[model samples]
Target: MTATATIDEVVCLRPATSTDFDLAGVINSLLKPVYELPGAELVHHLSGIGDVGRMIQDALDEAPDDLYATGVPSSGTDHAVWPVGGTTVEAGAGARLAVGITLPVDGSQDIFLWDQDASSDDLLGSVTISEAEQGQGSLSKLAHSDEEHSYYYVNYHVD
Candidate 1:
């Protein structure tokens, strides 16, 4: 008998025997975007992304009224750029890279990844970091690409 399953509406694989089946192989082939929840609710900005990350946190630490007055904390709006954290790295082609990001609030946040080397700062894509994520953790493949050295700028905020 053969075992088969439908994965992500694409790719079908059959296993001749249960013992011979490789689950890891199937997971690796599925290149679908994953949306994950945060491990903990974050009330403060995560540290260690350099100065911009700190400055954004400073602006957000102010009172809501003050934030509104200064227009620095751009929370609760679409298309708003909130500084979460960022890093630049060099990796081999098709290598999986892990990035740790900390976000504020116990709500949904969008994580944006950009290629700084590009003229337009080309946006690759975004993944939603759910409330289940902790203030600090590692996300795989934020640096995943075919390029020998990838330059990434990551930013995100609660929405």
Candidate 2:
């Protein structure tokens, strides 16, 4: 028997509220467009419209958080790591890791989500899947930090 697990995507429900700033003091917020237009153009068009322009500019200046994943097979001591997608995924966006692994029939594997940061990587959450869970189909686990939460979806099978 063989057991396999595939990570489909990581969905961000709500990002951490605390601003993650780089050395330049820029906030790393969500990268997804909130205003539907380019940030610079939006700021330019909204300028002289009072604090609304400044508010929009501030929101646009924020950058999305970078994320990645890791899978540790029960039979091995090393972890297989993969990037979620590009450099970052904004809140409310889903990033596809598409990482898969095969194991022995009786084996199990642990999957982890992490936020890559300039200082240090932060562990978002983790879940374990075993051969016993085969045929259960898709599984989702919600992992969270102090102020952020994300959903990790995986597909498991045994053959």
Candidate 3:
């Protein structure tokens, strides 16, 4: 008799949880080029003197590089706050940080996430976001790391 794989068996073999995905090679693939980019020193230097750049460089230097991640609701609430590490990235003051948040969907919501410098808002990069039905109450977070800067804002509705 020949052995055959069932759908259930295949599904079981696939990664289904965040931890499973985090362990997979996907994060490495996504982050390697970012750290290996040419003129890393120049970028870091231009970023100025702060622990934010150092922290990012250190994280990149590690064997398995990992980006920080956090999640929030898809809807509700007129105003929301997103702290780098749930507070200022450092214990001391005068630390400068300029991290960006890459939203799962584009044009889904205007200015979905923004830093203190509202006039210079920018998106981080492209990321795969799973499809969810409307009003499903699904939660999605703008995932990324940060530095010595302050809070971020999440505006759900325009009006």
Clashing pairs in 2: 29-63
Off by over 4 Å in 1: 1-87, 132-159
lDDT of model number 3 = 0.26
Candidate 3 local lDDT, residue 19: 31
lDDT of 1 at 150: 19
For 9-55, candidate 3 gives per-residue lDDT tens digits of 00000111123223334444543444334322333343465644345
Candidate-wise lDDT, in order: 0.26, 0.45, 0.26
List the candidates' TM-scores in order. Answer: 0.30, 0.51, 0.20
Among all candidates shown, the one with the greatest TM-score: 2
Better of 1 and 2 by TM-score: 2
Order the numbered candidates by TM-score, best leading.
2, 1, 3
Q: Please name the candidate that would achieve the greatest lDDT relative to the true structure.
A: 2
- Comparing 1 and 2 on lDDT, the stronger one: 2
Colliding residue pairs in candidate 1: 37-133, 38-130, 38-132, 38-133, 39-132, 39-133, 39-134, 40-133
On the 0 to 100 scale, the lDDT of residue 101 in model 2 is 46
Tell me how candidate 2 scores on lDDT: 0.45
RMSD vs true structure, all candidates:
19.5, 11.1, 17.8
